[model samples]
Target: MKKITVKITSILIALAMVFTFVPASVVATEDVTEQTEQQEQVEEVVTEEEVVTEEEVVTEEEVVTEEEVVTEEEVVTEEEATTEEESTETVVFDDINHWAKDQILKMHAKGVVLGDDQGKFNPNNNITRAEFTAMVNRVFGFVAQAELSFTDVQGDEWYAEDLAKAVAAGYIDGYPDGTMLPNNYITRQEAAKIVVEVFGFADMSAVEGNEFADFAYVGEWAQNYVAIAKEKSYVKGYEDGTFKPQSNIRRGETVQMLVNSTGEIITEAGTYTEDFATNVVVRSADVVLEDLTIEGDLYLAPGVGEGEVVLENVVVEGTTFVAANANLAGEFATVVVNAPVAVNIVEQASITNFVVNNKAAGANITAIAAMVFEPKAAVKVNGQDVVAGSKVTVSGGGETVVEPPSSQDPIVEEEHSVYEFSFELPTEIVAEEDVEVAVTFAATEVKDLGYENVRFAFAVATDVEDAEVTFTAVDSEGTEYTFTNEGAWGPAAGFAIPADYTAATDWTLNFSKAGTYTITFQLVTVDGEVLVEGTQEVVVLEEATIVEEHSVYEFSFELPTEIVAEEDVEVAVTFAATEVKDLGYENVRFVFAVATDVEDAEVTFTAVDSEGTEYTFTNEGAWGPAAGFAIPADYTAATDWTLNFSKAGTYTITFQLVTVDGEVLVEGTQEVVVLEEATEEVIEEETTEETTEEV
Candidate 1:
């Protein structure tokens, strides 16, 4: 925990909620057997807030450089060095502006390490993990390393990979033998050092946070790493600010560290909280990082693939882009990117660290909260560059037409009203650094925070695909937080969601603030227009407080189908109050037939359910439309449960329903079901199924 490399706040975790085709606010946890047929639920009162945010930096295209995509064949092959190659590789080189030649030139051109003809940048030579570890620490601005792992590193043993990644993720420990042989090739042990630094995040947001036992022994070589990490607040220490430096970090520990680093910090190992996260349907190109928590609800869209769903909190770590497609663990949520985070890249993994160049696969704004950082436009902390995939929940958008919020502006105070506004921020900025942002939400007449909804938005450009957009929440103390997410959105569009996992990025973020404060966002564009364009306003009259279970509306409507009955006609009774996002439609029951005969005519149907058993449709429309009340294909031929008109008298069918949250949308009979005639065979079968004949 010395320099901040293994802390949880610096990582991005995976999505917290189990993804489904249901609405974002609620998730369905049941034995869901059906996987086909997507049904749309009508939202009655959803306010389409056009939240367009302006940015502080130049256009995204200018702020970042797009990495040119290359295939394996395009890369310099391992074919034996030609005579011309050796001659080229032997050219004299200089340090400052090395006149690179031969293998060095090939490596440099292919995005590898650099050296010169005179002082040869041995591009074709084998490198060590230890070296990679060291380089990673340097590139990512890991707190200067103060400790070594085993004695071998300190011995005349070289660790190229370890050196690169260690420097990138920011920490390194020597071997049992006491000497760091800078020139010797490294082994797997050396490479793991860097990998562990980027993956061992522990969520530290809770009052009683996680504690590392090695808090006592500060390794002789790892001391510098421990100090800087602790100072930056990325790495935490015991109450005494001491960390266990000599312990060998584990692989799982690596996963844990990297995840915690991106955003959240946990104090306890087995402590888990169950929170409801809502997956919002995005109409805009840019996704606000904060909105998509590591713990989220269900996403109601129908899609597949990585690009279809945008990962909100994924981070990129490492000194170089290794293979361009590697994984990083985040706090509560994690995501995969198509580039190597130069600081977190593993050196020991490859002999020639420059063999493969890494870069992102571009990003798509028309995605599910897609986050993309323009190429090369990364924010730096203490001079160390935050990897390209780090999440920054910037809130500013494009310049707002509304005047900035100032006391001078007309103070439109109301008895109880809701206000709204929109603004923008840049994708690249320093953490814990309060940026001067501007927004103008309407001064609401509603004063209660319970009723008024506050929304924040950011934008991304369509052309910027394969780039990473990050969102992190930093607390006032400069500590980042954690989210528990699966990090996978259903596949539909061009992008494919990575397998669910936990990862993190290097940034200070936290969403657990005590009181009301202003927020900001970064705006992006698609087809040249602002990508996520729109606006809304909110007033934080009070802190965000938890509310009791309740329903906003209690109502019903006529089904979209006809209610008349000659034969067993299908008549649906809608018990939803259009504005219902939850509770308004759940656990309802209804019978189909003439008023009195309703109970006599047995009928059943099948449909998709979203909220699961949390609620049930007793009669019909109980647990939403997908529950049971659907028309059975075998009964009513409009093909389902047919209602037979035996005597053609006044008859009606009724329905009853309720929500798992305890709200009832419908529990009355529609009196709409009228049966005309049952087929002769059906009548005979019914008679035979329930008859006792006399001789």
Candidate 2:
């Protein structure tokens, strides 16, 4: 009995040691199994060892139970339980199993929408006007604020700032009663209008016919908006084919509409060819969208950092907001905003209304063509205020300079008298040739006390290189002043005009290349005070049909000084060519033109032959000959042309030889006088009597 009791005590001690060393997590299962087997063995040992006391056994049992309790408690401490719970937590909405569940979840993930404390997305609940505005503001990232005068809105309200942003963005407005019913549920038609305005779809023309059964029930003001939204696929009607315009829009429906409007978020850079049915957000740069259309707005997100996005033959049916620091090229319809970056409107690119938002303060916008701005848009180009709805002309690839509009009641300085200044140019001239320009300066109202020794100055400005201007003026005292200038806006030449003077001067302008040139003239006092100024434009061409002189060849024509009307006269024409080194002339031809006072009269040059082949000439001095008449390199006389005069008037005929390249070789004009038949008869009788007297 003593041995059995000792063995049972040793076994109990071993069991206690095993329980203490085991890990807490495995303690419960292993302890139960080991305790049962030991209990059975202990009972057998206890029966043999009657010396073992019930009190000792009970004490051991209590000790084992306390150890088990401590191990279980350690396995699941307060910190561990909290960590486990957090690991399984997720965003869950119990009521999002509806049609817009995906969209609602998407918006919730973006933190653009939220649920109640119970994690229930009550998508069927009506959305208020203020609530919708907040959603739109978040989507567009609009932070701009506007002054609010709504009677119902308090500055401290939750939606006050968002409503202000929407108003400033020109997408929301208050009622005529000066109250913005922020808490009121927005109807379908009203929501549609807001969506349309937010995307700049207000200018979109409505479809020819409505597809909704309740279309007529839509408010007249919101009808077009609803139609545009539906056409853009931003909104849809119910299953019953009726758009309940007056029905309040639910949260799920609002999310769906917003999602539909912002169709795709393009994050990768590539050339996209697929057309977007709705709005598109470009978050990456170097994206070229070609031959495609975006039915809704296009947003150049801020992620497009200092790169280029080209829109080649791409049409955006809605507004394009350029918020990225990127270069936009190619062609598109209109652009609303370009904040914090320079916008270069390249050549052949046009925009209908380039609205510069307030955020683009001090941003430089360069355009080759004229840009029209919004009426209330406050923007400055080259330190000049851009007037609303006015076209601002910008120089290509240079700083844009805008001229501010003159005030309605401008104060005119009384220091100098107002004068009418005008200049005349040929409007067109040939390059490398000199053309005459006439200028006139006259007072609109002559002052009795005319200022004496008024200085007249002329300046020439051109876009072409190496252009020149030269002229000579003689004053009343016969003092001649000659001046010449080269290049753009060179030094001006000045001369004095007498009092009560209406001065006119002629200047010769020559340009080395084909381009447009401007000649400006000014009348000022001897002290350099400008009285009047004017400018005129002249176009220089590469080739011209009518010119005063020839560089390659010279031509002359001889006709009867006087010929009787209804009679045929012979004209002898000759051409002489000069040697021009390095200029290999080819395909040289002879042509002539005739001008008369008779309207719609046909002048024909016919060779004096039985065939009577008529030569035709174009207004541009191009001719068609019966046979190609190539002019020889030397002085040559080939044709004796006969002309008939139907009317007794002085006629001028121009003869010229031009090359195939439209270069004039020889050009000259001569006049012929035609007498009436009765006058010729009287002259003939007088001539016969004079001859008899001489015999």
Candidate 3:
């Protein structure tokens, strides 16, 4: 079943020229970067060499089985049949040789634009602001962020949502008076800003010389944007040296500009050797290539010419586009597709992928020899899959899929599950705010805990005044567990688990007021023994602001960003306030959260008074929240907390000012640099210096 269709022999032996036509003036060239973004690379990593052997044609006995012919109507749904018929219809326009013909037609086929009803694409007509916004919306796949409120734009207007979307995306704006001149033609400078914003190129700061004679006429706000557009070749000056920033852009020129800014064209009849270059567009010409290698993208414009475009020994490194055009009616078949646009990939050619829009146009891709669709690639014709090494013939009528010789293995994906115990809590919260905490108990695989009546408890270690904790709900074994609060608000509360449950459970908690709270959860058996425990920290801020500077409780110090190890460092935390009475609360509790970014670094904090007196700081609270003494109310206080590091690296010590009830009013972090431990020789020298000084 995987063997190549016997047609390969006949196809390789015969090479045909499908048509003959003259060249058109439609020339398009897009840069590699723009096209590459749309392309999905198919990574081909072949570790084992594949062997190919010649196949001998053998005479087979006919089985005499009747062949069945299935009509499209019989197999496809009515809606699908209607859609197919509409997509294959022909699209013809009066303007054929215009420079923007290919771009306009391509966009039309893709339903990005539509010309007038007279089948005439008045390319020279000025494009209105509303029309341009609609086109941008289609081209960039923008959705309505909100309804337009502009006075000139009605709610039911077709372009209203598009205008709103453009504005919401911050790529365009309305006039100062909350009006958007939807009917007025957008000026060149205005369009430049929108284009630059859409492309995210607004930060190009280096200014270039005035590229146009009327540069002085350019507004100050748009000067930088205009310069960048010109510098990137998105816009060009006229022959008179004036940019005409106020000039209205014509429809044809606008299409050309949009296409040129994003893609490239190949008009000359020669091989394109630009490897890895993207956005290569071939339109309205009979082109021949010799050993072409493209790593970006290749676009074939629809109905541009009648001649065959031949690629010899071609290698497509990106997604190749066979049909890239659209019409104004938003119809798939917007252009009148003429003679078959035959793309002959010579024997031994390979394509990473190919895409064809059957609704607008089609291509005849003749694979003289073996053609490969690299692994992970997406190759489709008329919404159908084209197997690799298969000769695909797609016309305006239908598509044909030729089977390949060897079968490809279907890609299989592996799903890996990981176990992690985590909780979601706000890092910072205002004081007196009600907070809900969620904790997740998770495991990678199915597990059963053969236990009954397990007790779950959530505990707070920090002493917080007026703070209340309550268990909200617990979910386990596809059921919810409810617990009642018994006025046991401060320290800990427990919930009873039913029998025969799974390993994971979700717990919800509610807390009142603001404070530095050390939270711990424990899973215990009914026998009062703790099975597992976990801990986390939370800090709360005061809601009210201090009116006077003297009432502000503040802390400040110049903390080093980094340090080397083995070096003696001076560490001090300054505490300041206006007056003794300014300390609004009875006590200003200092809490230290010990943390470090350095691996295996030894850290010790020793509190010292200004008179060289040492005081001990207790870690009475739970881990991550070490409670210190209240600041002396006399006013400005400086407590030197000497920090000692064993290993050289960077570390951070966070200081929190919490209420006696456990609410954190203010907090600050100091980063210290700990260098690599001092070398033995340096340590000996320092020791010798101390001894010599003493003598």
Candidate 4:
């Protein structure tokens, strides 16, 4: 009951948010555009009344009690579940735009909608002319075609009238041929025209002013409409200042854009005042990590900029620290780092200036302790590679500089480093005739792991044709055994699994006990970082194993009659299931609803001889069920044929009332069957054995 209530509430919230968020000048219908390479919006449409009325009673008769029961049982054994059908299928919504498919439909019976000619919407498919027309028709009741001026449009065409009406209703346009090009892929311009027209906006003269980069491509006729849309907050440009007017808007972006455009942006602007002589004050919640420049004045806003709003170029003069991160919210707020971060932040907690001394020393630092000078292992520690990124223990004098603990938050690669690998050689002065092993370290770094097995990450690349770069882990203490690419040494593609290494494995790859080990990644290189390139270091923190998702499926059935071949027999069947472990599919139905119509139904002749010997008239070959055979035909006609379920399982069955629309939905089932009892010996064995097994 709680679950159902929550589901209903979530749907209501979504619907309300959508309405409040839509812009002032625009009204949007529930849109489900079919795009080949993009996902559609996840819409939850709840009635307005339902959103307001919390006290409304949900009748018990309408509740799916079986789901409640199944939900309880699903708490166990879900891992063993598997999909039985070879073909992939999903449920279809009653409307053309559906997230899931359903059988034994009711929405269609209410005259609210209709399925495609095949009686299936092909929910996962792209939309076609006929289908889109049908969908549009369902949304807007069929109307007499308003006379169209296009010569290509004809009354004889099935969709001709619909295309004409859609245009007449200001939904689309047609060429001079009178033919509305319904089959062409909808373009951005065409889409824009429809949107403006639908929103009841009249075409206007082009904006006779300087156009920003965002509106550079807007058509002359559509310029005024675009301007109005912008002023009314109906659209936004990308951060790069390009509106991408001609590009097809993605489904996710479309939703977000719609939300931003329509919602009221109320902001309570205030100033944050702080002393910048000692510290740096960031008024905006999000601060960039990149270097920043503020006018030679330092002052915090008297108070903070209050409210959920996209903060843009807020002015901050005086001393300032530019955020290093390329992307940060609230990029502009006048402030400064009057002093270096290290000195100021430590002593004065309230100081707004960042002095240069706050950096961690000794074992705390990582980039320095682990260094790969070559461009291959281009590891950047804050700013400096060798000195800055190195690990350190104490600061004032010389302290123990070793690896720290494992990295809790691992360093994620923004992009995959591309490289060419081969055993080819350049002839400056080679050791091996074919190749020379010149160690070039890719970018490297160590992670913060609170003293766990401290590990570092590195990358390697080469131009050798069947080339696999190997890392030879050597002791940082001595120069005797060195890095090599000979044996198993490279990590997995994701750099998750380490390759098996033999020489110096103890010092380099082995983590026999949780202690700090300095790992240096080296690769044989030829010259200035061209053949190979990548980040070099990362710290491994912990090992975790987890299982993802689980669910349950159960189904059962039995034949209707034993010997009623002379008359039509209504096959009795039911759905009953419970979930265990929930590792797989829930809400699974038995595929046993195949009705035996006159064409597919059959009656055959067969009898047993009265004597000890038996003779058969019509052989049972090719007799029962389609797709593989079942329930031998030689048995008495209609002798309650044993039905095969989509899957095998022991499910508790309970019938439910079903409805076409609102009438008494299907009444609960009366007849039920439990799996037959096992043999006494079998039961005894199961009880005695270490592991009980069932078939």
Which number leads on lDDT? 2
Off by over 4 Å in 3: 1-91, 264-695
Candidate 1, residues 52-117: lDDT per residue as tens digits? 123222232221111111122222323222344343434443321111122233333322233322
The order by descending lDDT is 2, 3, 4, 1
Query: How would you encode candidate 2's per-residue C-alpha lDDT over 428-463 as one tens digit per residue?
Result: 788878777677777667554455434556676876
Q: Stretches of candidate 1 above 4 Å error?
A: 1-112, 128-130, 134-143, 147-171, 177-181, 188-695
The estimated TM-scores of all candidates read 0.17, 0.39, 0.29, 0.21
Better of 1 and 4 by TM-score: 4
Q: If candidate 2 were superposed on the true structure by all CA atoms, what would the RMSD be?
A: 31.6
Q: Estimate every model's Cα lDDT from 0 to 1.
A: 0.28, 0.58, 0.47, 0.30
Q: Write the per-residue lDDT of candidate 3 for residues 590-665, one digit (tens) a residue.
A: 6775576666666666675556666544322221224435554455667766566777666677787777678887
Lowest lDDT block of 10, candidate 4: 16-25
Which wins on lDDT, candidate 3 or candidate 4?
Answer: 3
lDDT (Cα, 0-100) at 335 in candidate 2: 85
